[model samples]
Target: MDDDRTRGAGERIADARKARSLSQRQLAENSHVSLSLLRKVEQGSRDATPALVAAVARALTIDVTALTGQPYDLGGRHLDPLHQHIPKLRRALTYWDLPPDGITPRPSAELVRGAEHAADLRRSGNHAQLAALLPALLTETTAAIHTAPAGREREHAYATLTVLLFAAHSVTYKTGYIDLSTLIEERTHWAALASSDPVLGALAAWARTTSLLQAGSYNIGLQLLDRAQADIPTGREPGESVLRMSGALHLRAAMLAARSGDSDLAHDHLGSARRLSTQLGDVDHDGGRYQLAFGPANTGVHVVAAAVELGDGDEAINQASQVRITSDLPKIRACHHYIDLARAYLWTGAKEESLRCLTTAREIAPQQTRHHPTTREVVRMLIRLHHRSNTQLTRMAGWIGHDA
Candidate 1:
């Protein structure tokens, strides 16, 4: 029997179309799905492809999650702290005052070490450790910023604050705390501006652009990147840090462009990133100096991810095969690479290969994969294809909290 969740997807499509006063034929024409097919999908007699679901949602001007519903949402009981912290983080953004009551500005040395440690946890994919550290980091950085009477020390404190908030925004956006993510992004920009450095400010904007990409706001993200790119400082032998920062921004622009279907533009930005990656010192083959990890290996991972996003699965697989995941690579990045490769295999009808990739991802970074939105969708797609024939697939579906 067809489950209500599956049938309910059709119900949402139908309801949304009707709420907009569109007929079946109208929706079919608008979404570019066949009228007969749209009718079947609406009546729940047939399942829709992810692409079809996306197209229909686009036609209706709603989020794809709105159609999938919460049952398919990733992040479970373990993410409860993230859920609680989102509101608290939002309140921090709203107040915009430095140092919550009874807090003293921490020494710059303490703040720097704390940030470096937190970033280490992030690269290792130790999210629980990072989570434990973030709230205090956010508080201490805020206190440090206004503690000094307007000078370079205060500016440096604000820059550190920007980095902390950007890191928070990345986690919140991925874990589905979208509203809080937006606020955190705004705060990053504010801190960057107060830091009185163009590069730092643009990096903050880059973080916000990444959040926009998470929300599928590709056009807006690309626009933001273009604006941010203009701020790339021009002068005297731009050193390693400057190169890494510039490269990170271009790399993200490549991804947004790829998703938007501008292949030439995407490749152009990708080339810019590749050039910068070479200049990023020997340590970066693992991932660069910056938290964003702009390096050769990471750029290659983005190339594969970009291919997957552009629906070029064969290209994605071909590129993925060449990309090596070394131990030094950030587990967060390496995990996403496996997920991207798995999705590519699925696109090419290599179901078992896709399953293997998923298994590897779970082995490498269980929590991140289990909580990721893309991971859920990939598992759902696999279930749709192999659930009846593969016992392992069924078990995997259950593990990911899906009932196929």
Candidate 2:
């Protein structure tokens, strides 16, 4: 064992706990480790077992990688050679053709359930589990699409595949395979087109728009968003599903517009989101939030995010304060909200508050908070504030595979 490395790990744990405002006794109680063990680890007197490390990481509201100072890998191998799918997926995304590709009428419950469960895992920030599940899901969804009878049943199959492809995009994006994620996004849009539900097809646009925004193709993304929304009818007021779907698109446009420095356009889109969310009883239905999680709470969070992007940090924080009903949001969305607040706090030089928000976000969705680019930027700022010390800030830098 490397004694020096072990001690450094201990220092990180101690620093992370202090950063979160937890005492040794509190962290011990929270992590369910004995106080003596926690103290020893903190004081560099002992090393933690893998299980102990994981528990402590969770208690500290950080990714296990943070404590371990390693990249996220499944079983330390990261990914099995057999588990590699992104390369194949890149080619398949160009023309998604499932063998025996006919949509089955009345797809088996097991088949439907599998797709839903995979989406659930993706949404819940279970990247490791999702990575294990996605390849199998792709195969099953392909099979389900192939077996379905023509017409509505086949449409359902396409819809299922769309969901699975979107899930693929999500997990892949989180894993840092940005190009592969974009391919999956393309595949999702293709699947959505084959599905009869135009609204669903519009919802699929969310995936591509996100990729475009991340890639800095801001105008193209916003243009596509506009085109997709243009296809949806506004006659006699749209239904809840349409409102949710279109409102979700508009919010994406809002964020993109804000990033591009179009404050009026951003606010216009935001106003649309607020109106739609208000009409839908203030929340997008949790079960079917178009996979985008757009609602009043989420919209407020986005407003803050856009404000942060626009350099209105104080205004962003103020908007964030108005988002009080966070308890009902999806964990991922709640995590995003905190990260946005953290960025805003940092922008305003409110370092302690920013750190608090980051810690809170980690508590909500540690993996997402740890891996997200915005969160990473905030941590970089924190490292600077800590004078690039080998203490707490350096420890956090380790979590994200960075050096202070």
TM-score of 2: 0.74
Lowest lDDT 10-residue stretch of candidate 2: 73-82
Candidate 1 lDDT tens digits, 19-59? 99999999899877789978876775544444566678888
TM-score of 1: 0.84
Q: Deviation in angstroms for 247 in model 2?
A: 1.2
Residue 14 lDDT, candidate 2, scale 0-100: 84
Encode model 2's per-residue lDDT on 181-224: one tens digit a residue: 76777788788899876776787787887666654467898989
N/CA/C clash count, model 1: 0
lDDT of 2 at 345: 85
Please provide TM-scores, in order, for all candidate models, with all chains considered together. Answer: 0.84, 0.74
